[model samples]
Target: MAFKIFHPISFIFLIFILLAPLGHAKRSTPSDKTSSAFDFIKKLKGCHKGNHTKEIHELKAYLEKFGYLKYENKSQATDDDFDDILESAVKTYQENYHIKPSGIVDDATISQMTTSRCGNPDIANGTNFMQPHGNKHESGSSNIHTVSHYTFLPGNPKWPPTKTHLTFRFSPNYPVSSVAPVARAFHKWDLATHFTFAQVGANQNSDMIIEFHRRDHGDGSPFDGPGAVIAHAFPPTDGRFHYDGDERWSIGSVAGAYDLETVAIHEIGHLLGLGHSSVGEAIMFPSISSGQVKNLHPDDIQGIRALYGR
Candidate 1:
């Protein structure tokens, strides 16, 4: 059995879910030889997402392609937290190119990562890429790292090892009308991860931003173009997720492509503290194909449970 999880969505977003080419081509995948997921992230292209021009642009394009952000911002996170963000971003990128959003960070993601990945390691790391002396910060504008999110997300202040409830909020932009589907996704967390969500407004003590856009909107990771980058987020402390509005998000089986919900599920995993699995069957795997992402695969469940020990 597929380990069914259930819950009904309380709120929903009404937006176009899918907008990419779909066709069940005879399961022929191109060969990719990259080893680690990050190395692959560096090689994705805009069409294949194999070679993004810039890291910031590549990050945004990945978010836009997937169209969902599970984490929020303005709070805190860390390099380890980036493990989740990068894994999720990589998964999203895979979904765009009709790959699986498995969170493995395989050859497909590497093939579609930023264009800069294939060149010098320093440039790929954004160390050698320097802004011109006159390229100082302008009022109302954020740079590459601070464009849409923060690179140095100070760890969570209230890093409680446990929580009350795991609330799953639908982005205000996506067309997620069916409460059942949204709730189904949330249920997966409860059953698999075991974290319950305390209605954010039940006591009404806190609120954070969980939406997406291009350029520096105050966070850190910024969007590059319409179809290049996806979106980013701050981990648990922030719980804010931003999705670039410049791409197409779809649902259901789209031939040889991935489902939007599948990508969202993987990104949500990041928001919840889980990182990439490096295993294809794991939901944490870096990528998935069209039909493969409709449901939560084994690898995904294993990763979540391992983190929270659910």
Candidate 2:
């Protein structure tokens, strides 16, 4: 056998090359990557139609990811130019979020865009589910009326009549501490809706699967780590609920941590066929603040009732 000898300097250089990737891996965490992913939107706050900046491409991608922007062809969706389609998408997004439909990216728009929200699209399959449907009478009040902001996934998918009782199971990799909070969330929905939910062992078959995932975890929808997209779920019959493992999650209100039960309630709504609600206080609202604990608002109850009957 022949052995190749390296000079001292060459050997040191080779060792550095081997260890360089390890050092980089240590520094580049999910939070850092997520921050860089969405930080560019802050720079495009004032951009409008006809303004072409490289950052506009990022804006287009953000809009596209949440179902605000669509394209007739591949070329139309790829460019950075702010065209009529882009303006229309922006206006529609503003309208859905209750922001002024100025067709320009304003401070409020940027604020809403950067807030941590669910991974599901505000508008799915050309349907703007976040828009208020109309005014509705309060459940008990004779004279008071409120706007109904609850919505459903496109085509209004729901569990069949035969499947009134559903089973849920956590992934084998799920945190053991998360079970109680998540179970409480399911109980909240159980009380509000007609459906009954039960927790099954991980090895047993289940109607729904809940798991914590980071970045791309095989599902078509990937999480953006801590700040941007916290969690997401699929509609009924598809039953995949995912939380971003990168987030600082707690059982209840913690100064800087997300409330696991609150997020669980919102995602569970999706698994039951509800969509994003325009009402900010509703459990089905797209975004949530850190350390906040939200319960099922009247609007949330109404939404579920509307989908599956009271």
Compared with the true structure, all predictions reach lDDT values of: 0.41, 0.82
Q: Please give the TM-score that candidate 2 achieves against the real structure.
A: 0.84
lDDT of 2 by residue, 1-310 (tens): 1011122225555465356422311222224323535677899979999998888878888999999988887777888899999999999988888899999989999888888889899887887878877765666657666779999988899999889999999886465556788999999999999889999999899999998878888999887766788899999899999888777676676655678899999999999999998888889989987668899999999889988887
- Report the lDDT tens digits of candidate 1 across residue range 1-310: 0111112212321111222112212231234121322342453333223322334333443343333233354221211233455555556445534568776545655555532111101111222111111213345665532221111112312225656455545444433332334445556666666676433432334322344455555765655533333445445656765654433333455433334456556556657754444334445444454345445666556545544554
TM-score result, candidate 1: 0.46
Alpha-carbon RMSD, each predicted model: 16.6, 10.1
Please give the range of 10 consecutive residues that has the lowest summed lDDT in model 2.
1-10
TM-score of each model, in listed order: 0.46, 0.84
Best-performing candidate as measured by lDDT: 2
lDDT accuracy of residue 152 in candidate 2:
90
lDDT value for model 2: 0.82
